[model samples]
Target: MNNAKRRIDLVLLPIVLLAAILNGYGIWNDQYANSYYTTAVGSMLRNFHNFFYASLDSAGSVTVDKPPVVFWIQTAFAYVFGLHGWSVILPQVLAGIGSVLLIYFMVKPTFGLAAARISALAMATVPVVAAVSRTNNIDSMLVFTLLLGSWFLFKGTKQGSPWRILVAFALIGLAFNMKMLQAYMILPAFYIFYMLAFQAKWRKKIILLIGSTAVLAVVSLSWAVTVDSIPESQRPYIGSSETNSVLELAFGYNGLSRLTGQQNRAAGAGMPNAADDRNNRDNASASVQGSGQTGNSAPSGNPSDDVGMGEMGRGMNGMNFPQGGQMPNGGEMPNGRDFGGGNGGGMGGMFGTGEKGLLRLFQTELSGQASWLLPTVLLGCIALFAGLRRRNITMKHKEAAFWLIWLLPVGAFFSVAGFFHQYYLIMLAPPIAALTGAGFVAMWKAYRERNGWQAWLLPLSVMFTTIFGWYIMQVYNDTIGAGWSISELIAGFLMTIILIVMLNSSHPWKQGMVIAGFMVMLIGPVYWAFTPITYGGNSMIPAAGPTGSNGMFGGMGMGGRQGNGNVGMTPPNASGDADQSFPSSSSDESDVDNSGTGTPPASGGNMFGGGGMGAAGGRGGAGSRNEEVDTTTLNYLREHNTGETYLFATTDYNQAAPYIIDENEAVITLGGFSGSDPVYTTEELEELVQSGQVKYFMVGGMGGRGGNSDISNWIVEHGTEIPTSEWTTGTDSGAGFGGQSTLYEVKL
Candidate 1:
């Protein structure tokens, strides 16, 4: 037994190494993965106050959108590693790899060694899982926390221990803190598994489940309750909430809005209505220029810089295209003019979810991410229950049912949910992997024994999965080349046929054929998984595919550059007509100059540049320049500092994030992320200026959302605008405000 255990462990080493390479390779090249969260991690490391609230800036003005648990872990890592992109991303990387091992151990106890090995490989190679693990998004860590909970849940069921069950529920609660209601997607699976697998009386089972429920509620709501109970004056306003309430943020924006489309509302209370504000801004812009530029327009000469804010706002608010919003050069934004509350159509459609229907998962937009193995998983589900009698419920049957329960509802949710990114599909990976591993063994054994319908499931599953993979490949033929898909289809069908022919032969021949068939089935996903490392992936909205046209991967190609050519604003044509074709550069390097200063200002291209929505080592959009502050500007601000609490204040976090990351100083983000959160009133702003807490105010950029415009208007009326020549050097204005902005010195 000991020797066998050693050999099994040896076999697992290569799988672990593969996961590490897929998740950790080339991560150091990432300067700052998702600067929004990266900035928060940097701020949290400053002191205990920011650390506890998960503050987005060192000043602790407002908290991040999510709860603090994951950020706390990231902050600890930044503390040890000195807060680089790699430092914060390190936690998720480790979590992703750890999930692979957990899948192996969880399966090994009941499903045997071969099943565990296959399950681990599946978890490691799913494209979306690898894409998310490479970034600092909370999904990878959330998945890990849930998987750990599953391990405990499985152990409790095996031993019938209520204590282990309670521990499992507690972990789920912790996962809720990680991502709120997303963690609860697995609750039904846990509940059903415990009721079916535990060998207690019905009354005892009900009592135990009730106890677990209480524990889950306690753990899940503990942080939210504590944060909500604190006085509004003492704590920072909840970032994305409509009423400055954490509970509302969780249940509304991050919860129901995930299912139903996000409603148009300001981020906090005492804010102007979103629709009215949007209309007023549209009328203002149209009256000023009559150029059809509405709320989406940035300052002249820097058209594409603010396009990311539109993308960010749409992504957060359900892909609502601004009315009459024209891209630079008169190009119309994609996805039609339907604002909010509608289903995205097929491939390259809105939200990357494809059409909302039963076939949604099979569509080109989503299939390649994690659904490549669904055909096999579905067939495996049938094979697992074949020839089973209701009276004889074995551990294998119970485990299979647990994974199926896990897969179906989550799959259904994604199929219908109004708002979600492609990376959220990582939730489907574990169950698909588990069922694939267990089903393969069960069907193989049935085929050898000639167990009727079970005998053909193995071959049928391989053929279907192979064909499905070919369809996904064909969708990306322009980027990955069609010849590769053709080869896979031929090789996969041939292997399946050969495996069927060898059924009457010896065990070794049959096993070889089966292994060959599975290998062919894995070819596409493995290649898709490698695309992130090869071409680079979007750290902000992580998706896997080749970069070129806006197909399923939405042109996320060539070192993580957005493929749709939404680079910095599009430039005008020779005839002065707006060029509709947002042309993208073929190169794999950032077009913006670093300006000889080691610290690049996080401006131009995407809001976070290559680190945010901009392309990695490529042009973010056409005519985009580096938005980093020039040395002259940095020196001016430092020299003119008058002991203010903040270095300077900007309308939005985008204008402020780069400085926070580069300088590690207090820079106030007045409008929060998306520049839409109403964090202050004009009177409060006047008070801040009067007390000398804030002296330098940047008016314009992506700030002044909703009710916050009063603050900007007040500053312009009373303050003095600093001359650009005094602070700017060269062509760069040192501000990527997504629009024209003026610096104002506000004094009594």
Candidate 2:
């Protein structure tokens, strides 16, 4: 190889290695990463039918709320590697590394080695990207598939081959199957870029775009067509859908609901949105009330009621409290109109919140994690346009246009989009990194030539980034104490001085200043990413950064304070009473991040506060025990399965996932996730009981999932509630299922 090529290879190798280390370092630490999906993977490994539907149980009773593409890849690895946590998560890690390498090659062909190296490193260190890649979540796969499509498109645009363009759109179709509509966000850029860059006549260009669009549609819907074609009886129920249809699940729950915020509450028996879910959880109790049952009903009140505030220090299950001040004289909340709040949280509200409009993406909860470099990236895109003005559009210009289009639309969408997890921002990382790389080089060239606009641009970008970095760290400081923010500020100040000195110094120092600026800005996010790996963070609502990580604090409180490790998700201290930081049960959704799975509530501006990390600790620790199965309850399930296809059935997948994962048995969920999707009618359930397909029904309550009132009501009326003490320990262990899972044997 030539000198320049060899040097490029050397830089590329280390960046790739860095990405692998970031993703692979604590692989074994989080054994059952995101137990909700991990359980589904375990079930999919059982047989072909379950595999095809992405079923959450061996009996093929119900499917996960997501598409099957991610599970398909995870299952293939489990098939070859024998189904360990490492095996399940291996695909994402490999995909992440491959993404970095692909980006390097894609940029190297156009922007050269310097831009390629910058882009690769920028993406490699992004906190949320590392967080998702290290777990079984499919966002990494979606990102990889999209990047892969970009690679093919890059080749097609260069070669002027229609077939290559067809392949490019086809890969995007594959990406669609991975993440539903999210994969389509970049298509406009892909189309416009191809049109501008393709060496073809106008008529030919339109024909090519039309052909690719057709290929895109055909490939995107192929899996949906086949799955929908299967008879409902033979396939698993589509979780989270109002109707038992994958297409509806995709178009409604996963598609339109995300944009319009018009939730099809036709399924979830009208549980209030995520915010009200938190209020209901706090003011009420986990115990459900029925004839001759010991559960408590909710008090008639709004979210502002302090009825149950004093019980916050009790335990993670947020139940078993003495009810008086918070309820009526009989230890029950006064009956009234249905709970307030709307249908949000869960899968339907993927991109919504009470907040909206342009600045929404910059909220503290979002900025600290994914948006650490967002401002600079946006400025870089603008700088690219300004620098290239009045010039004929070359292949490079078209490439720049593509990256900007890919970035701005998605950025604007998230800014104003209603509800979404912070990790969803991973989709924007690549384009941001690419634009920053190209913009930096262009600005640097102009600066070397003493061009006034370019000279000011580079320093101004660095200066603005330093100020933003300091602000983000300050937010981190307030949310998670221990003076971390001050440290970041000091470091940033030192870097700013170095940048100023280098900019004014001789030739050798100018390049060094650029490297310093990137490093200084990267310091905070890189540390945040490391926090999850070190302190351990894998939740249904996955986040990254110090706020996302379980930190130096022993236990977290709902107000985002350090607790005595009693009432929070962490085990109580030696004393039963907790450190008096706050009070409320674990059931309160506000205390938890809830992003990793189920229906995450509308996450507003907790952006920099590490507020979610407090709840992340309640998820139990990393390692083999991470799955948090109640051994006593699991053994009861195994012994009494009695030749039934399902070992037990619960209200929703979150309630059933631990048992399915721990026992590797078919633990069916009656209503699917959010307890909104009707997996089985009461009549159908009775038929299953008669056929011996199900026996023990694990009931009582599940957060957000109590939406399936009919099934819950049916089980209460027909099934015999086994006394809590009979089958397992009555005390809440602060682990899986919170309190003892209230079990009931269906009477034949």
Candidate 3:
């Protein structure tokens, strides 16, 4: 037994290492994985007040949109490691690795060693899972938490221990604090598993289920109740809630908005109307086209035309065509729309989730992320139940049903839900991994026994899944090259043929053929998983693919160029230092050092105080950079300080993130993230200024989400405007506030 356990441990070691390497390698290069959350981490480190609230700034002005559990864990890691980019990312990486191991342990006792190993491998290789785990986003941690709950739930059901079942629900409630309602998506599976597997009278089982639910409610609402009980004056305002209430924020923005496509309304009371958004988008499009360069620029007049296809396009072309393959008619190929941009059909498509339908998961925008193994999962479900009879239900059959229940509701949600990011696909990983692993073993046993139609199910499953993988590759052939699809097609067919031949004879390598068939199915997702490390991924969006410099889905759709926006157009200085250029409105390029250090050239006068429109600014917004507050600006703010509570005030979190991260000082964010939240009104700003809690106000940047226009106007009317030369280096590019930024000194 000890020797067998040692062998199992040796195999598990490599799988864990694979997950760790995929999630942690070169993470420091990102500097700030997602500045929004990174800023919150920095603020949380300042004091217990901000820490408890998950505040976005040190002043405890407003909490972040989600609950505090994940950030609380990240905060602990940051505190110990001094808050570097990798420090915060380390927790998620470890969580990701832990999840992989959990899958092995969960499946081994019931499904055997081979199934457990396969499940672990499937979880580790999922592209979306790895992509999200590499960043500071809460989804990876949320996934790990949910999986932990599943572990306890599974154990409790097997042992028929009511105490363990109670503990399982409590852990799930803790996961609710990690991501709100998203954690509850798996509850149906938990309830069904316990009801089917636990040994008790029907009435007694129902009563225990009710008691467990009561425990869930208590653990889930503990933090929200504590937070909402605090008076408005004592604690930070709920960041994304309409009524400054935690429960409202949870049920509204984080709950109903996820399914109803009403995110704009639930996000906050104030948002830019359609006309303003259209005008801004139009102006941003014109700026991109007028200047021949593209780097983090916003979408153009047609949102579909804004696909950024620079490096990935070239890479694909090099792979497919011996001589450089150019799009016919000067970089114009078929219009495949933006890979994951634009509202393809509905509100969900706006955030790159693709249109709502049965086929939504299979669409190119999402398929490469987590759906590659879905075909196997569906066929494997059939294989698992092929020989089971209703009168002879077993624990294994009950467990199979548990995974199916977990998968269907969650998969159905993503299929039809109106709002979610691509990385949210991680929710589908666990069940798919488990079903694929367990089903493979079941199918293999039937094949060896030659159990009628079940014998053919194994080969059919492999062949169909391989074909589906080939189709996914073909869909992206224009961007990622047809070479991969063609290679996989040949290999998959050869393996299928060999497996079929081996089934007819008492072949010694039949198990080897089965493993090869699984490998053939995995080729596409493995490549997709590796792309993030090969080409940098979007830390903000956390999608797996080649995103180019614009950091959206690049080269995954059709077309090369010839749009209002420079979708596939490479910048003239593509090979030069990225910090030297800014997306300007004029055709002539500025020689400004965009690192916010050097003075602007005399020919290119400072736009710091000018009315000229520059690029859209924010961490993941078009034309933005992950830059810190320049030394000159930091020095100026420090010198002018009058012991105010806040060092300065800005229109939104985008404008304030850099300063908070650089100095860990309080910088008031009038609006929440995206500048859309009605965090404060002009009257509140007046009160803050009068109380001497805030003295400096920076306004008129592209980052203003229009909710705080009144505050900007009030500052310009009453405060003294400091000249651009006072604080800014002439070449100062707004860290997140695009265009020109003006500093105003508001007096008492």
Candidate 4:
């Protein structure tokens, strides 16, 4: 047993190291990566108030959409590591590596050493796993937590310790705090698995189940309950919920709305009409029917609503522009730009909106990332059932049943569910990896033990995986290009030949063939995973594949340089009207500073040059310039400050985060993300200004959410814009496209 254990450890060592390296490599390059969460991390570190509320600003005005569990973990690390990007991201990297190990241990007892090793390797090489682990995304921590729960539950069943089962359920509850309803996705699987596999008597088992569930419910709601119990006036506004309730957030925006496709009233892109009728009614006066934006709605009568339209004549009459409700005379209101448009490819495929039900998971966008070995795992599950059918359900068969159950419900939910993201696929990885490892071991054993149809199972699994891989290459051909297809085909053919050799060859050659075949099966995703690292992968949307031009992975590379164009997921001409793709240069050259502000310098052109919705390299118009707060602006705010809590105010966290990171000052965001969440009313902000709590207001470009109309209108009507000449410095005036930051002074 000792010798066997050592050999298993040796076999697993390399894959573990590879996974660790992939997850940690070059993780620090994108400083303040994904300003959305990074901003929150910086703010949460400010005080206990920000920490508890998970506020976007140190002032504790508004909170991030999700709960604070992941942030708590990140904050602990940031405390020690000094708030650098790596400080927050490193915890996720370690969590990812630990998850891989847990999956190995979780499967080894039932599947044997061979299956355990394979499962770990499969997870280690999965692209989405690599992507999420490397970024500051909370999903990695969430995935790791679930895997840990699985480990404890497996141990509890084998040992008959209700304590272990309690711990397992408790951890799942903690995971709920990490991502709300998403953490409970695996609960049904846990319940069924425990009931079938535990050694307890029927009555005891029922009691254990009920008690553990109670523990889960309590642990899950602990944070939500605490936050909600506080008086509304005392705590930060609960973000992204219809009512200002965390429970509603759990059930609505983060729960049913996710499944039902109801856009979050306070988060996401444009405020779609699909939102609850209450949101529409609440913002009725300000709400315009459509400007084609998604996350937050820009209000009617704001000149910003008609930004960049050559034909201002479209709806000028309806707009109540801040300047006495008069429309800014037409021919495009300088630098007005559109974002997040275009028909993304894979729209009609299996996992796309076009493909409605179970077949969706089989599509290219998903299949290539998490399902490389899906067919193999499914076959393995079937074989496990067949081999043990004659025997009464015992520990062995029950264990296999547990994995199958785990795979089925979650797989079915994501398959037919309305919403899907590449990162969400990480939740499915463990089960898929487990079955692949154990199932492959089972097939290999059946093949060795007999000269029956089971022998064909191993080869059949490889062939199926290869065929699916080929189809994935074809589907993503636009992003990855035809060149990748040829390589994948060549690899597939080579894998086929190796399988044949293994079937006919003697012992020594057979072992080698097995290694070669596994490598061939994994080569594509492995190669894809490394490509993201080589390019400083941006975490805009964590995914695995060739880098797209300013896409999730590709944009993570050095300063927004176009990706290799190898990734074909993006459709050619999918982005509508190239002319409108980016904001054109302004004739007013005064707003730009030629001085070296760092890299491209602080100017209009650099700001709008190459960013948009989901633009690669983290340079989205408003989001692109967050890492570097303009020193000039920072200095001016510092020079003209009152003894107040916040340094200044912006519509959202985009502009505020830079100051928080660079100046160590709290910047109030009037609206939450996209300026959508109603954190404070106009009167409330006016009171803040009156009391000298927040004295400076910054408004340039679109006010996030529906903030621009109200705040912009109020500031213009009640406050004054400090001209670029007075407050700013450099060869250019301080203004440019959507990315430029303009300052204003509001009088109490």
Q: Candidate 1's C-alpha lDDT? A: 0.66
Better of 1 and 4 by lDDT: 1
Q: What is the lDDT of residue 275 in candidate 1?
A: 47
Candidate 3 lDDT, 1-748, residue by residue in tens: 9888866667788989999988888776655556667778889999999999998777787777778999999999998888766787789999999999998999998999989999999999999888778877788888898889888888888888888889999989999998899999999999888988999888989998999999999999999999999898898878757788999877876687667645333224433345554454345423422332111112111011111222112112211111233323343222334422244432344334566788889887788889888877887778888768989888889888988999999999988776566778899999989998999888888888888888887888888888878887787576578888887888888888887888878888888888888988888888877666765454555566543221232232111111112122222322222222222210000000011111212111111212111111222222232234556677888889988889888754545766777577788876655444556777888999888898997664433333444455566667887766777766444422234456778996
Name the 10 consecutive residues with the lowest summed lDDT in model 3.
586-595
lDDT values for all models: 0.66, 0.58, 0.65, 0.60
**What does the lDDT come to for candidate 2?**
0.58
What does the lDDT read for residue 539 in candidate 3? Answer: 55
Counting clashing residue pairs in each candidate, in order, gives: 15, 25, 3, 38
Cα miss at 659, model 2 (Å)?
2.9
lDDT by residue (1-748, candidate 4, tens digit) is 8888865588788988999898987666555555556677889988998998888777888877788988888888988888876777799899989989998888887777878899999889877788778777778899899988988998999899999999999999999998888898888779888987788789999999999999999999999999899998999877555577899878865677545443323232334432332254235333311221112223211111111111112212222222222222222211121111111221112112224466657765466567777878877776777656555676667777777777788888766554344567788888888888888777776655554777777777777777776776665566557776666667767766666556744666676666666666675668666655653354544556653322321212222222343221211322222211221110000000011011321222231221322221133223234335667777788888867667888764556766776567888877665455567777888999888788887654334334244555565556666766556554233322233345668887
lDDT of 4 at 261: 43
| lDDT tens digits, residue span 1-748, model 1 | 8888866577789999999998988777666566667777878888898899888766787777788898999989888888776887799999999999999999998889989999999999999899888877788999999999999999998898889999999999999998899999999999999989887899999999999999999999998999889988787767766788888878976787667544435555433343455554554433322321112222111011111122234322211122223333232233331222134522114334666888888987788889999998988888888767989878999999999999999999988776566778999999998998998888778888878768898989889999999999986676668887998899888988887787667767677788788889999999988777765455655666654222112432212233322122323221211211222111000111100101221333232111222321222211122223346766787889989888888764545655676577778877555445667777778888888888887655444445455565666667777777786674334333333345778897
Candidate 3, after superposition: displacement of residue 19 in Å?
Answer: 0.7
Model 4 misplaced regions, further than 4 Å: 1-8, 264-354, 474-484, 494-507, 549-562, 566-623, 702-708, 729-741
Q: List candidate 2 stretches off by more than 4 Å.
A: 1-8, 264-355, 387-391, 478-507, 549-627, 703-707, 730-740
Clashing pairs in 3: 296-622, 296-623, 297-623
Better of 3 and 4 by lDDT: 3
